[model samples]
Target: MTAVWRKSPQDFGDALNIRETVFVKEQGFANEFDETDKTCDHLILYDGEKAVGCARIFPDGEAGWHIGRVAVLPEYRGKGLGARLLCEAEKRVLELGGKMLCLSAQMQAEGFYKKLGYRTVSEPYLDEHCPHVRMEKIL
Candidate 1:
């Protein structure tokens, strides 16, 4: 399947909906929806006409981009959509002249982030009731 990436408000909303469903509803992250969404650059991965995955990146105020709210529909997992979405987000950040990327990855998905070159920088901590580790990558 061909994956197309785009930056658009509506597409960003679609991405947020998927992330809210997976992280907030399914995972019980009561505050998963945060103010960051309002200021972040959102990247959406579409397969044909379907939005399969998405990620959001924001300027961290410390000379880096903070990546968050990455998600893929359950049926779309295991197909590398997540990776594709993340790569697109990274590309977008680089295009904007960002050289650092940071994220707080759910502990369960730490390995996934590591595979993508993210290094854990902090011990696991609680975020919205879920354990997470701060990770970063120098682009």
Candidate 2:
């Protein structure tokens, strides 16, 4: 395992690169980026200056903070980088005065989020071809 650093990137294109690798090319998603990328709080995980993982969080109006687009490069998975990135995002939400966080998690990765204290809040649904469920955790 390698030591990692987290940054609130001035350029979210760094986040996009990881998301594109995990959520787009590897996952076969056509529409990956969205307008929300322009406004959300974006985080990137770095291993000695190389961006390896990322996530984004923001308020959801009536719902609270929503966390999404979390991705870690294939070579960097299983090293606890994902968990560290998410925990940092949770901390970021609290810093932004949020008491809760919600996310739409791909069913295959649902267990990973659950281990971090997120609970499924919605039945499985399809995002394109992938099945996902809504989950939440209170801060």
Candidate 3:
């Protein structure tokens, strides 16, 4: 039950693997990996030696930070790993002097983000063929 969060190059690979399994192969987001990852900071969550979840954060001009590509292995869902990854991402954003955080949450995940204090800022829209809504949280 010990989970660790950290920044590392390996996180990119681990995150991509999870995204591919959940978003691409399963959900069919053909272009899931985009240019944003090039300039953003990624956080990885490990349950013992297994990578269970990950999230990425980037500067959103001066408005604050933008979080993206958050995912957890299917078998790992409902265990709070996603929330833990988000908490770690928010901490990293705050460490960088950010005052707010935003994300385009998949419609199905809006409730989960809401529980984490994120408020919807827009109506649902299509993102990669899936319904998504913009959400934000003020730090």
Candidate 4:
């Protein structure tokens, strides 16, 4: 079985680890870690005792809540863990008084976000050479 646990900013080490694996080492993203990781709450999805996926969420002033740093371990991909991690973040955001969700989805992963109800709201833009689009979903 799999479970998701929330970690406050100070406890985001696990989230950082996964991001390093997915976005840094694998995706060649140099801007993986940022100041936002210090403020957002992280959600780590675990399969049994192993951490498999992660995402971070925080208020977005105009967009309700922002979800970012979404990552899943290579070995854990294709098992729907990413979706579970996202749903958990949404639940926590709602609990934190949010009514909408916003994310900067990588162009390649845009369809995944769309399948989960997010609609692109911006023109494609480059983030460290990888194209991305801002997407939002009313919760």
Compose the digit string of candidate 1's lDDT tens values, residues 16-95.
77877788777877776667666677777777877777788888866699988888888889988888877887887899
Q: Rank by TM-score, descending? A: 4, 2, 3, 1
lDDT of 4 by residue, 2-25 (tens): 555555665667778888889999
TM per prediction: 0.89, 0.91, 0.91, 0.92
Best by TM-score: 4
Model 4 segments beyond 4 Å from truth? 1-10
lDDT (tens digit, per residue) of candidate 2 on 1-139:
3333333345777788998899889999988988787777788887877888888887986647999988999998998988997899888788878889999999999999999999999999999999999999999
C-alpha root-mean-square deviation, each candidate: 1.9, 2.6, 1.9, 1.6
Lowest lDDT 10-residue stretch of candidate 1: 2-11
lDDT by candidate, in order shown: 0.81, 0.85, 0.84, 0.85
Tell me the TM-score of model 1.
0.89
lDDT of 3 by residue, 9-49 (tens): 55467777778898888788889887776667877777787
